[model samples]
Target: MSTTTHETRIDVDPDVPLVRITREFDAPPAKVFRAHTDPELVARWLGPRGLEMSIDHYDCRTGGSYRYVHRRGDEEYGFHGSFHEVRPDELIVQTFTFEGEPDGVALEKLVLEDLGDGRTRLTSTSLVDSFAARDAFVASGMEVGVREGYERLDEVLAQG
Candidate 1:
């Protein structure tokens, strides 16, 4: 078994208005792609560590809608998004809105690549309307949450 801590690549534009994060998983591309579209799988591993998720609705096809709520103790965060494009095993594009800050919505593009060595690399790019908004999100400790979330995903994949 290959025991390697996957490094997350996050890029923020100092002049532009976008944030990008790339991560690699030990699982195959098919499995990784399924995790994103499958409601059961996503609800199991798609939040910050210790946050429980409740899926209100999930339709992963093109032009479909997805809504979910994440609960952390007494606080709950809701997110709703619309899928712009959904190409199986390849790419997905969507518009995301956070109920916490409705004005902080973004367009997200996620691409999955099969690395051929029993690994899959997922690259997620999020474009906000302003640089300040992008910066604020990056400063919000989302990186740590992302790391923990992926670690949870690794555990989920390992279960089977």
Candidate 2:
């Protein structure tokens, strides 16, 4: 058995209104892609651990749309997005919007790279409309969610 640990790296562009995230997974690209496209698998590992996620609708194909809600105690947060392009186990392009800040829509692209040995690297970039918007996103404690979510995903992938 191989014992390897992966960490998530988030980079905020100082000049451009973009944020880039990179993480490695022990599973292959296809498996990692499935975890992202499948709503059930996504809900299992998509956010911070304490929140309960409920998907209103999750259509991951090209031109498909999705809406999901995360609830923590008495607070509920909603997010919706439209998939612009989807390529199985390779790429995904989408628009993301948080209900709280409807004006701050972001265009995101995710790419999965095969690292051989049953491992994969996932890189995602989110481009917001303005630097303020990007800064706000980074300040929102998204790193916690990203790190914890990937950790959960590692467990999910290991179960197979």
Candidate 3:
């Protein structure tokens, strides 16, 4: 199904070690990349709509570290990770772990393609250690959160 806002098409292959999600954005690759690196912009669209994000630390360079918390009412979730690779306007690879569910941690890579004409395509692939880890991520409602987060990102991009 198509969405009025940006759409993320996720594909899960049981035999593959990764889950991939691809989406197109009206913004340029550089602008989209900056939205991911800039802590303020990142925080604004990092979690579910009802949740608020607070970045304790964020360093987007290679080998850099990041820690943030997602809060909704009285509940809070913490996530911390380190960047494995960073290629500005091209790709980003990182290890991501949620404190609430460490078993679901995975190595994630985001590849950005500049479609030109003020458009970009982002493909995110997360490689997990086991199928169970992947299953847990799906069961945790992360897909919904990710979609919502991107919708928020669309709004942020449109505002500027």
Q: Which candidate is the best by TM-score?
A: 2
How well does each candidate superpose onto the true structure, as a TM-score? 0.94, 0.96, 0.94
lDDT of 2 by residue, 8-93 (tens): 99999888999999999999999999999999999999999999999999999999999999999999999999999999999999
The deviation in Å at residue 40 for candidate 3 is 0.6
Q: What stretches of model 3 exceed 4 Å from their correct place?
A: 1-4
Preferred candidate (lDDT higher): 2 or 3: 2
Over 4 Å off, model 2:
1-4
| lDDT tens per residue, model 1, 16-44 | 79999899988888888888899999998
Each model's total of backbone clashes: 0, 0, 0
Local accuracy by lDDT, each model? 0.88, 0.94, 0.88
Clashing pairs in 2: none
